[model samples]
Target: MSSRFKMSDLGLLCFYLGIEVQQGHDGIKLLQSAYARKILERAGMGSCNPCHTPMEHRLKLSKASTTAPVDATKYRGLVGCLRYLVHTRPNISFAIGYVSRFMEQPIVEHLNAVKRILRYIAGTLDYGCHYKHGG
Candidate 1:
């Protein structure tokens, strides 16, 4: 492939984009712990207490929420970062999607929901996808 394309041989993949890679005799693993941490720190929740779940049960969010509005730009940024984190953290995908609906006019309630996701990530940052080697 190098003969056909101009690309530098960076050696075995360790990190690409925001995902971390680990290769071993058993298999390969894809992780985004660092990226996740960055998101939490950027949102000023780096030291937030961890939660067992990303969201509360029976969570009901709406475009016409009655709560006061928060900074749309900041809310969007957090939701966007959380979305990218879904690549290796499917567990939080649904919660992120739920909160994303209010990106245009996020309220304190919506932001609180996003915070829960960050807390959950803090507790499970090491979680990731693993691919086993075939026999």
Candidate 2:
């Protein structure tokens, strides 16, 4: 409260910590398109083909799968970024959560799965939830 600590008005919040905010008559909207793009670039998938779905249906991933191991640190970093993006992109939450389970021992297949997610993000960069003033 102003009665307590001194504070300055920052005006309407449009962007913060990578999340984009928009205000209008309908309501406020939030998205992370910029953040998602950065993720794709970090993984060298900025120009990858877009996918309709985040992950293929009936997909199954297990540690027993015989695949070459990937860089644990890199995989973890990507997954971590994706997790933060989930705040404004819940559509990819399930996919990210699924692949994150292998952070300790990521494989080539897991990396591919992550790439698929990035591709999906590319196709749906404008996809985000809109909160109307009233239900």
Query: Best by TM-score, which number?
Result: 2
Q: Over 4 Å off in model 1, which ranges? A: 1-8
Model 2 segments more than 4 A misplaced:
1-6
lDDT of 2: 0.90
Give lDDT tens digits, candidate 1, residues 1-135: 989999997789999998999999999999999999899899998998999999999998887867899999999998999999999988888999899888888899999999989999999999998999995
The positional error of residue 124 in candidate 2, measured at the CA in angstroms, is: 0.8
Residue 64 lDDT (model 2): 74
Clashes of 1: 0
Model 1: how far residue 84 lies from native, Å: 0.7
Model 1, CA-based lDDT: 0.92
